[model samples]
Target: MLLRMPTSLSEAQRYLAEGAVPVGGATLVWALWQRDGFPEQAMSLRELPEATLIEREALGAAVLLHQVDDRVPDVLRRAASTVGTGAVRRTATVGGNIVGSTLRCLLPAALVLDARATVLDREGPYETDLAEVVAKRHLLLGLRWRDPVTSGYYKAPGEAGGPPPLVVATAVHTGSDGRHRLFVAVRDGYDVISETVPCHTGPDRALEALDDTGLGSLPAEAREAVRREVTGILGGPADR
Candidate 1:
C-alpha cells in the first residue's frame, strides 16, 4: 500500500477523495490491515495543522490520548487515562479512538458531553454531532464541546490487556435557562444507551432509563455490572 502524508487539510481531502483511507494513529488501521486488507492508498494526517491542537474546548483529531489532561473535562480525561497502557495511550489518537471499529471508552464520554466533530470531506469542513461522525467513520478535523459543570466516566473491568464490555459516562451541563441538564451514556459492545434528563433526577430514575435500551441483550454479568456502575455513578447504593 502507498502512504501519503498530507501537510494541509485540502491536500488531505483531495487524497481522501481520490480513495486514500485516512490514518491517524494507525493503531486500528494496522490491525485491520493485518486481518482484512484495507484501502491500497492511505493518507497520514499527522502533518496537518488540525492533527495537533488541544485547547480548553477543542481537540484535534490526531491529538494523542496521553495529551488529554486535567485541563479537559473530567469524563474525557478519565476515559483517556484508562484506555490502554502508557505506551499504547501515548500512540493512540483521539480520532482513531472515535472512528475505530473497537468499542473504545472515549465514545461514551463524547456522547455525554454532546461533542461536535469538524469533518473534512470532498466538499470542505462541516460541524456535526460526534455520534454521527463515529457512525459513518468520517474524516475528522477536530472536536468541540461546551465544557460541562461536572462529569465522570467508569469502565468495567474485563481482562488484562482486553477491552471492557461495558462503560458508563455522565455529564452535567447548564442550559440556557440556568437549569442543569444531566446526560448519561452507557456502552456495551457496539450497543449504546444515551439519555438526557434534569440534573436532579434520582438514581432510581436514572437506572430506569436503561429499561428501553435493550440492556437485557447483554451477558448476565455485563448487565449486572452496568447496573452497578450506573447506580454508583449516580450516587445510589450498590446492589448487594
Candidate 2:
C-alpha cells in the first residue's frame, strides 16, 4: 500500500477524491493495518498547513492527543489524557479519534463543548457540527468553539486494561439571558446521548436519551448501577 503525503489542502483533496483514505497520526490506520482491513492507499495530512495549527479557540485535526494540555480547556485535557498509554497518546490525532469507528476518549468532551468542525471534502470547504462531520466521515481540517465557562467529565471503567463502560462530559454555558446552563454527552460503550438542560440537572436527562440504544441493551441491574454511578459523579437527581 502506498502512503500519499500531501503538502497542501488541494493536493490532499485530490488524493482523497481518487479514493485514498485520509490519515492523521496513523493510530487508527495502524489498527486497521494490523487487522488487514485498511485500504490500498492513504493520504497523510502531516505535511499539510492545517496539521499542527492550534489557536486560542481551535485545534487542528492532526494535533496529537498528548498535545491537548493546559492550553486547552480542562475537560478536553482530562479526556485526552485518559485515552491510551503515553505512547498511544503521543501518536493519536484528534481528527482520527473523532472519526474512528469506536468512539475514542475525546468525543464526549467535544460534543458537550458544542464543537464545530471545519472540513474539506470533494465538494470543497465548509463548516458544520462536529457530530455531522463524524457521521459523514468528512475530512476534518480543524475544530472550533467559543470558550466554555466550566466543564467536567466522568468515566466508569470496565476492567483492568479494558474499555470503559460509560463516559460523561459536561459543559456549563451562560445563555443570552445570563443564566448558566449545562450540556452533557454520555457515552455508553460505543453509543452516545447528549442533552441541554438547566445547570445541575444531573444525569437522568442524558441517560434517558440513551434508553433505546446504550442503556436499553443492558440488564435491569446493570442499568441501575450505571444510573447510580453517573448520578454520584454528576450530583443529585434531576432538579426538574
Candidate 3:
C-alpha cells in the first residue's frame, strides 16, 4: 500500500475522495489486514488542527461546561482501549474513532452529557448535534459541554481475534434544580445513545440503583430489579 501523509483533514478527505483511504498514526497495515486486506493510503493527522472549546455554556438548567482546551479529552483516549488488545490501542485515536463514530467509542461518552460539536458546514462553523453529525458522516472539529455528575464506563470482551467491539454500559450524571440529571448509555450492535432523567432524587439511591445495573443486557425486568435491590442498600435523602 502507498502512504501519503496529509497536512490537514481536508487533504485527507481529498485523498479519500480520490480513491485513497485515510490512515492515522496506528499500525494501519496490520489493523487493516486484521479486518480485510491492505489500505490504499496511509494518512497522518498529527499536523491537523486540534479541537478546543471556544466558550462555556449552560447545557440544561443545571450543567456548566468548560469552554476550551487545545488537547483531546483523556477519558476519550482511555475509553478506546476497551476496543481490543494492545495492538489496537497502540494506534487508535479519540478524535479519529469519534469522527468515524465507532460504537462504544468516545462519541458515546460525550453524547451522554450536554456536549455538542461545532464543525464547518457549507454555511460556516455550524453547531451539529453529535448524533446527527455522526449519522450524516460529517466532519467533526471539536466538542464542548459542562460535565455532568459522576461518570461510569463498562467494557466487554468480544470473540477472540477480531476487530468488533463489545461495550455494554456507560453513564453520566449531574444534579440540577434539586433533581439529579441521570443519563444511562448503552451500545446496541452499532448504536450508542443515552436514557437521561432530569428530576429530583437521592444521589445515594441513584448511585446504588446504578451499581446493580452493571453493564450488559439489562432489559426492563432487570432494570427494575436493580432499582429495587439498590434502594434497600442505598442511604438516600428522603423525598420532599
Candidate 4:
C-alpha cells in the first residue's frame, strides 16, 4: 500500500482531496482491515503539527490518548484512562478514539463538553459540532471546547476489558443568578441513545428533568444503576 506522510495541513488536505485515506494512529486502519481488505492509499497525518497539539481549548485530532489523559480536564482524563491499557493508550489518537469506535471512552465526554470539530474536505476546512461530523462521516482535524464548571463521567463495562454496556457523562454550569445548565448524554453501547440539557437548581431537579425524557426506556435495573452511579459522581443529592 502507498503510505504518504504529509507535513502540513494543506498538504494533508490535498492528499485527502486526491482520494487518499487519512491515517492517524492506524488503530482504525487495522480494525477495518480485519473486516475489509486494506485501503489503496493512506496518508499519514502524524507529521502535521496541528494533528498533535493541545492548545488551551483546542485539541488536535492526532493527539495521543495518553496525552489527553495527561493534559485535559479531570473528567476527560478519567475517561481517557479507561480507553485501553497503557500500551494501547500510547498509540491511540484522540481522533481515532472518536471516529474509529463510537462506543469508545471519548465521545460521551466530548458531548458533555459541547465540543465542536474542525474538519477538512474537498472545499477546505470547516467547523461543525462533533455530532454533525460523526453523522456526516467527515474527516476531523481538531476539537474545541470551553471547560465546564463541573463535569463527571461513568461507564459500566460489559466485561473486564471490553466496551461498556452503558456510558454516561454530565456537565453543569452555573450562572451568576444561581441557575444551572445541566447537560447529560447516555450512550447505550455504540450509540448515544439519549441526550438532555435541562435547566435546574439542584441535582434532584436535574435528575427529575432527565427522568421526564423517558429514562424508563432503559431496563428498569439498568436505569436505576445508572442513576445511582451518576448520583454518586455528582455527590449525594443536595440542594443548589
Candidate 5:
C-alpha cells in the first residue's frame, strides 16, 4: 500500500514513469520486461490515494476495474475469459486496459452506470468523469461507481488464446435515492453517453424495467440493453 498522490499525469508520469516504460499493475511491469528488460522500480499501488469523484472524472481504467469486479455471473466468467486464458486475465489490470486504449469487457458496464471515478488529490477529494480521465495518460488507482445502477457487459473474443475483439456494455438502473443512470460503451476507443429517466427501484425493479425494455425482446441478441448471460434468464451473452 504505497500511497502516492500525484496532482496530475505529469506528476504520475515523473514519479512512476521510467524512461519510456509503462507502469501500472505487475502485468505491465512484466510485460515491459518481457519485451525489454527489468523495471527500475516495482511500483506498488495498493496504498495509493483514494479516488476522489470530482467532476465525474474518476473513471480510472478498464484494467483496474477488470481486476476488482468480483461479481459472480456468467458475464463475469465470460469477461474473465475475454482476453487470453485464466493466466492472462489474472495478470491484466483494468487500469492498464483502459490506459492502453484497448477494448476491454468492463467498458460496457462502466458506460451504462454513467459511472464516475472519485479522486483524492492534494487539494482534497474530487470526482472525474471516466471519459475525461482516460482521455490522456492519467494515473488512476481506484474508482467509486454510483450504487444500485443496472448495467451489463458483452464481449466478442478473438482467436482461442487472445483477447476479445470488442466488448459492449450498458448500465440502466434506478437508485434508491430516486435517480436514473443510463450508460453505454462501444468498441475499444469510443463510448456513448446518454441519460434515461429513472426506471428502477433496485434489483427487484428488474421485472418492471425488463417489461419496459421489452421482456419479450430479451434473450434476443446482444444488441444494446439488458442481457443476463450470467445465469440471469433474460438477455445475456453465452455463459462461458
Candidate 6:
C-alpha cells in the first residue's frame, strides 16, 4: 500500500479525491487493515502542522487524545481521559475518536459545546456541525467551539471496560444578552436518543426536564442513577 503524507489541506484533498483514505494516528485504520488488508492508498495528515494544533477554542483533527487532557475545558479533558490507557490515548486522534468509533466519549462533550467541524470535500473546505459531518462521512479538518460558562460529562461504561452504556453531557452558556443557555445530550451505544431540553430555572429544573424525554423509559434504578450522576456533576437535586 502507498502511504502519502500531505503537508497541506489542499494536497490532502487532492489525494482524497483520488480515493486515498485519510489516516490520523492510524489506530482505527490499522485495526481494519489487520483484518481486511491495506487500502490502495493512505493519506497521512500527520505531516500537516495545523492538523495537530490545540488552540484556545479549536482543536485540530489530528490532535492526540492525551494532548487534550489539561489544555481543554474540564468536561472535554475528563472525557478524553476515559479513552483507553496511556498508550491508546497517546496515539488516538480527536477526529478518529469522533468519526471512527461507533460510540465515543468525546462526542457527548462536543455536542454540549455545540462544536462545529471544518471538513474538506471535493468542493473545498466547508463547515458543519460535528454530528452532521459524522453522518455525512466527511473528512474532518478540525473542530471549533465557543467557551461555555460551565460544562460536564458523565459516562457509565459497560462491563470489562467495553463501550459505555450511558453517556450524558451538559453545558451552560450565557448569551450576549445574559440569558443562560443549557444543553444536554444523552447517548446510549449507537443511539443519540435524547434531545437538548431548556432549563430556564436552574440545575433542578434541568433534572426535571429529563423526565420529558425518553429517559423516563429507562428502568427506575437506571434512571435514578443517571439523575444522581448528572446531579453530582451539575449540582442539582440528586434525589429527584
lDDT, candidate 1, equals: 0.77
Instruction: Estimate the lDDT of model 2.
Output: 0.74
Q: Give the per-residue Cα lDDT of candidate 3 at 198.
A: 39
| Per-model lDDT | 0.77, 0.74, 0.48, 0.72, 0.45, 0.75
Give per-model TM-scores.
Answer: 0.82, 0.79, 0.58, 0.85, 0.55, 0.87
Steric clash pairs (candidate 4)? none
Kindly list the per-residue Cα lDDT of model 3 for residues 1-240, writing each as its tens digit.
787655555665676566664443343336555689776665444455543223333111001122112132323333544544565555554445655535536665566545677654433346777777677755455676664434444545557655444343333444554455655555545666455543235545465545554433455543443344234322332211
Write model 5 residue lDDT over 74-162, tens digit each, in one string: 23333445655567576566566555544545545554555565433334345677776667545555555544333456665457645
Window of ten residues with lowest summed lDDT in model 3: 59-68
lDDT of 6 by residue, 105-221 (tens): 688788877788888887778889876877877778888887776777777756755656677777766666677666666676666654455555655777777777777676675
Clashes found in each candidate (C-alpha, N, C closer than 3 A): 0, 0, 8, 0, 41, 0
Q: What's the true lDDT of residue 165 in model 2?
A: 63
Q: Point to the candidate with the largest lDDT.
A: 1
Please tell me which model should have the higher lDDT, number 2 or number 3.
Answer: 2
Q: Which segments of model 1 are wrong by more than 4 Å?
A: 34-40, 161-163, 201-240
Model 4 local distance difference test score: 0.72
CA lDDT, candidate 3, residue 20: 60
RMSD of each: 4.3, 4.9, 8.1, 3.4, 8.0, 3.6
Once model 1 is optimally superposed onto the true structure by TM-score, how far is the C-alpha of residue 99 displaced, in angstroms?
Answer: 0.6
What lDDT score is found at residue 233 in candidate 6?
Answer: 52
Worst ten in a row by lDDT for model 2: 231-240
